[model samples]
Target: MAFSLGPRAASAGYRLAVFDRIGSTNAEALARARAGETGPIWLVAAEQTAGHGRRQRSWISPRGNLACSVLEVIDTSPAVAATLSFAAGLALEAALRTVSLEARMRSPGSENVTFHLKWPNDVLAGGGKLAGVLLEAETVAPDRLAVVVGTGANVAAAPEGMPYPAASLRDIGIDIGAEDLFGALTDAWAEFRIVWDKGRGFGEIRRLWLERAAGVGQHVSIRSDSSTISGLFDTIDKDGCLIVVTSDGRRVAVSAGDVYFGAAASVGAT
Candidate 1:
């Protein structure tokens, strides 16, 4: 069966395209946007075969999961583009709250269940993973750009033998209908767009994000291609960089790196 959203859920101004299955919502939305697709387009799929995550990791997407992407055309700097993930994280958190999951913001630790934001865009839940966000942008016309925001939430079950710990909404005893979750996400996106257009700055979004931030003030290890650094998790910069205070008392800003907490932090640094 095809997935369709009701009018009361999403903004009436936007157009939604639903699919029974797809290779990746982000890829489809990117192709359409590059082909001159206009603003406020939502691409959704019931299952994804080749879903993507940050740093080219395979996002484990199964049937009955939520895989969707929204394409928006806006004129903004790359810095603003970078912050889109954080904004989306806030929006996703709000969507989850609507389902009454009692999903509080948490960092990776020895606790039972915790969700945290890993730098640019990954939502970690409990001892396992929950959801993630991906943002890709391209300039199609002069002063005009296309931004594709892709999101995947483990509504039913997580992939088997995952690289890291992962979780699903069902694991937490929250049974949110997939369609209802999609509606909430779209509505949240619409609200975020309004804030983005008004140039109100990222203060509000950032504040909400930090409130749910993972590993803030905890020791973390960030690994990139060339090197590794470990330090206390500080704050996310306006440009979306993960700020870490190293043991040497130097605050190093990590622009792009895989953040790992707990014992994985030591392993990631190497």
Candidate 2:
């Protein structure tokens, strides 16, 4: 099927570029932004041959899924830029709710069937992987950065030969149209972009994120390099780092790591 930019971008007064297939939407958006693509451009594709996740993990991109990148210019430090992923997660949750999916910010003890945020940018559903967000920023000018927020949501089906468990919207009985879903996402993102532009930083965004956090104050394990630490989920720093209070009461700030909750009890230790 040929990819087409739907009415969402036009209604939002933004330009969009759609492709039938691409190596990666995020990479394409970054290139375009560097080449002077202005505000609010979307790069979407039906298939991504070389999609990637954080830490260079391969992302599966089937044809009938949501694979898109949103490019926006923001003036902020790298610290604040890191928080965009959390903000995007909130927007995505709101977008899912618009389609009657009962999506909310995931945190520990949510009582919503094991949904929670897997640290910086993953949304968990029913104790499995649901969706993930990736934020890539580059300095376009002094104090100015163009942020490309890439997201992949399993709308129809999840991957089969993956290491981790994955879920799709259809698995939860959500039968939303793809066009409607993308439109809702763009609307939510536009509204959140305004919040970021107003110099609110990540305070308000962080609070909303924590409300929907997947495993706040739960025993969790985070792995980085050759070391792993188990701790209670503490809080998120202003820069969007995961703060974990270890068993010894020392709060360790994890900027990057693979987080596993219930890993010790459910699955064997990592």
Candidate 3:
């Protein structure tokens, strides 16, 4: 099925560019922004030959997977632009719930599936990574920040043997297509984008994100480029940083890092 924006997104004047295959939707969106395209546009690809998540970790989207990015140009600081990813997380999770529920109802007695947003930028299902969100921003113009919120989901298949466990909608017994999921995401994004209000409504977004967060109050270890910190998953602060309470009762707010929970925290620390 061809990809098209949902009714709400279309009404919101969000444009869409669908590709059968692309190198990266995020790359394409940023390129458009640099070319003076000020847009709230969605770039979607059936497959992504080359895609990377945070810190250049490869994220390959094969056929039947969802590879999409939403681009917005706004006058905002990079710090504020960073919080947009939390809104994106909320949007994606809402979309996943909508599509997954529809798929589940078709099959009688399908096992229940729950989704949660992992700290930083991942969507988890059954305690395994189901999808990931990445935010990339650049100063294309003097005062315009070009922010691209990119997401890739394993609709049909999940990679095996990764640092953490991975899962797919199919693996969870939900038969869904990338096109259907993309449509839902476009609509969901429209709603959350308003709630975000170009970072003005981040307080609401932060609260909503924490409501569906994956590892809050659990043992967690965050690994950054320089060092690894182990602590309890406290909560995300107003600015959206992950706050972890160390064993010594110090609350450390991590701006960026790879997070692992429970026993895997040790493995992630190493």
What TM-score would every model get versus the actual structure?
A: 0.89, 0.87, 0.98
Question: Per-residue alpha-carbon lDDT of model 2 for 1-270, expressed as tens digits?
Answer: 344444544676767787888999999988887898756787877777888999889886777778888988877777677778887888777776665433323223323334466777887775567778898989988888888999888877888877777887767656654555677777788767666653465688888889988778788888778888788888888777889898788999889887777655234235
In model 2, what lDDT does residue 110 have? Answer: 28
lDDT of each: 0.77, 0.75, 0.93
For residues 1-270, could you state the per-residue lDDT of candidate 1 as single tens digits?
Answer: 345654643545778898877999999988898888976788998888998888788985787789999888877766677677778887787777765443232322312344566666777665667788998888888877788899999988877887677888878756666776788888887777666552355777777788888788888998888889899988987667889998889999889887888678987877
Ranking by TM-score, best first? 3, 1, 2
Q: Model 2, residue 5: what's the lDDT? A: 44
- Among these predictions, the greatest lDDT belongs to 3
Report the lDDT tens digits of candidate 3 across residue range 10-104: 99999999898899999999999989888999999988999999999999999999999999999999999999999999999999999988886
Score candidate 1 by TM-score against the native: 0.89
Instruction: Name model 1 segments beyond 4 Å from true.
Output: 1-9, 101-115, 198-200
Off by over 4 Å in 3: none
